[model samples]
Target: MSKLDALPHGPEFRFVDELVSLEPGKQALGRYLVKGDEAFLVGHFPGNPLMPGVILIEAIAQLGGVVAQSDPEIAALKNLLLTGVRGAKILGAAVPGELLEIEATVEGRLGGMIQVSGRVSTAGRELATAKIMLSGEE
Candidate 1:
């Protein structure tokens, strides 16, 4: 099974479409296609629809969770959830038909908390960057 399957999200809420590369506890790369048919897009803008900045951050956090949960040395945490975000910058917007490339690296882990840094880009242009924290039930 794909490492992404470890995530608790269902298909509708899941953001990472494919796990391109994974380094267990170290890092991971994933992708998501921005299809115009997404329900949220209809209300995001009347005529022009852009992937929300929060969604980009969610994509990054999802990949980071995959990386953290796959670590051989660490037992899987239950209900891992994004608990915090810092230094988030929304640099660009992703439109329909864009393939977002997301990368996340595990910065550290303390108790049931994991800290990660991530970036989202498409066509060689960065869309967002952030440092996020996730916590899971011990």
Candidate 2:
């Protein structure tokens, strides 16, 4: 199975489309294409249809998970949980028909807990940023 296939999230909830690069426990880069017909977009803003900020944060967290799971030891620990989100800032809105590029870097790790900082952008412009924390089950 591909690395993404190992993640706990299913197709509908999986935000990561392609893993561009990864540095085991250090960092990861991924991308997703918004096709404008996603189920969640139907009522996100009606006419405007902006991609929600929470989804972007989730995307970042997923990318961070990709990085965290790259380590063999962490991958063995399933069901990683998101412990917290910090310093989240929404600078702009991502619309349908755009390509979302995300990157996450490991900030720290203690036992099964990992801290990561990440950002989401489209067309090279940053749309949001946050620090995501994930704890592996011991």
Candidate 3:
């Protein structure tokens, strides 16, 4: 099983569709498969479908958080939790049945928290970007 599959999240909560690449302290690439039957799509504007912004951010957080926790410094802390997100920009929309590639880069670290930036794209078009923050846990 992949490292992501071993995590606590499962099913719909597992936003990462694929683990494309990982370069410590540099970047991490992941993929997500948007499903037509996704729970949010049902009431998300009905006929007009768009992936929810929160879900988009969550995917970024998951991808970035994985990178942060992998660091020996942060990993030594035992647990980690996503504390917040900032500067989230949804440049385009990702529709159901689309495959998304997410890239997260480490920006810096502060105390028990780590900062990262990420972008999600497909077909050479940008879907969303965000500055993600995560905190070391007990």
Candidate 4:
């Protein structure tokens, strides 16, 4: 199993496939492969399947969480929850078999919460972008 697979999220819900690179409390880059046979693809569309925007946001958040958790202080807490999202926009649709590249940058931290902004893209095409807040738990 990959490092991302070891996160708190289960297999069915884990959106992060690989941690390509990371800089604690600064930034992170990751990728996820959209397997055509994924459960979400079965009913997302009948004749045509498309990755849902929510999933894209989740992927972004998961990537951001990995970045935040890279900090020794946050990792020691052992839990991270997405608390808020803002300025989210989907610019394109992601299809199965494509590799989704996710990137996140830390904006600041508020007590136990880490704020970040992220973007998702495939093959150099923008798919989505959002600002998210994650709270760490002890």
Candidate 5:
């Protein structure tokens, strides 16, 4: 199974399209394609649809969750959730037809909480970056 299988999101909510590389607990790289048919795009900007910053953040967090759950050294936690986000910056925007490259790395861990740093980029241009915290039942 793909490392992304560790994530609990359904098809509609899951953002990462493919896991390009993974280092179990250490890090992961993934990709997503903006298809323009997403429900949120309908009202995101009628004529000029753009992916929301919040969704971008969610994508990062999802990848983070995948990284956290794949750690062989730690017991997998149940029901992993994105509990916090810090220093989130949206430097650019993504539109339909753009492919997003996402990268996340495990920064540290405390009990059932995992801290991750992540970024979203496409065509060598970074669109967003953030440090996110994920918690799961111990």
Candidate 6:
């Protein structure tokens, strides 16, 4: 059980709404829903409410960010950046009213680069999964 953060997203790009739980690299989960006022979704379909693939990737990255920021292994690093998304898949689509449960567990860390693999689910159904990466400040 975790609560959402009220961080101001740059532009209209708020990817996540909550910080469910984070345990360094071991595990992390977060949640979010589409904001009606979001420009991207406003005309994404005009009538359909699909959480886009890019947003899903962002949600995963956000979780990865939290892990990097909290993990003592990389906490002292001034900056942490989510460096990649697989970029070749749409595991599934998340609907507007669905509560997404995104979970991540650290898979490996090489030097300052950390990798976390995770999945996104809506009501117990997996929507998407990916291996996200982060790099600490040099």
| lDDT by candidate, in order shown | 0.93, 0.88, 0.80, 0.86, 0.94, 0.68
- lDDT string for model 3 (86-136, tens) is 989888888988999998888888777788899989889998899988777
| Cα deviation of 79, candidate 1, in Å | 1.1
* Pairs with steric clashes in candidate 2: none
CA lDDT, candidate 2, residue 30: 93
Query: What TM-score would every model get versus the actual structure?
Result: 0.98, 0.94, 0.88, 0.91, 0.97, 0.80
Q: How many clashing residue pairs appear in each of the predictions shown?
A: 0, 0, 0, 0, 0, 1
Model 5 global lDDT (CA atoms, 0 to 1): 0.94
Error of 2 at 107 (Å): 1.2
For candidate 5, write residues 1-138 as lDDT tens digits.
877776788888989999999999999999999999999999999999999999999999999988888888898999899999999999999999999999999999999999999999999999999999999988
69-125: candidate 1 lDDT, tens digit per residue: 899999989989999999999999999999999999999999899999999999999
| Candidate 4, residue 114: lDDT | 82
Model 2, runs deviating above 4 Å? 72-75
For candidate 5, the C-alpha RMSD (Å) to the true structure equals: 0.7
- Structure candidate 3, residue pairs in collision: none
**TM-score of the candidate numbered 1?**
0.98
Q: Candidate 3 or 5, higher lDDT?
A: 5
Candidates in order: C-alpha RMSD to true structure = 0.7, 1.3, 1.9, 1.7, 0.7, 3.2
Model 6, 1-138: lDDT tens per residue? 332332224546757677777776577778776555567766777888677877777777767666655666554344667787663356788766677877767777777787878777887777787887777765
Query: Lowest-lDDT window of 10 residues in candidate 6?
Result: 1-10
Candidate 1 regions exceeding 4 Å error are none
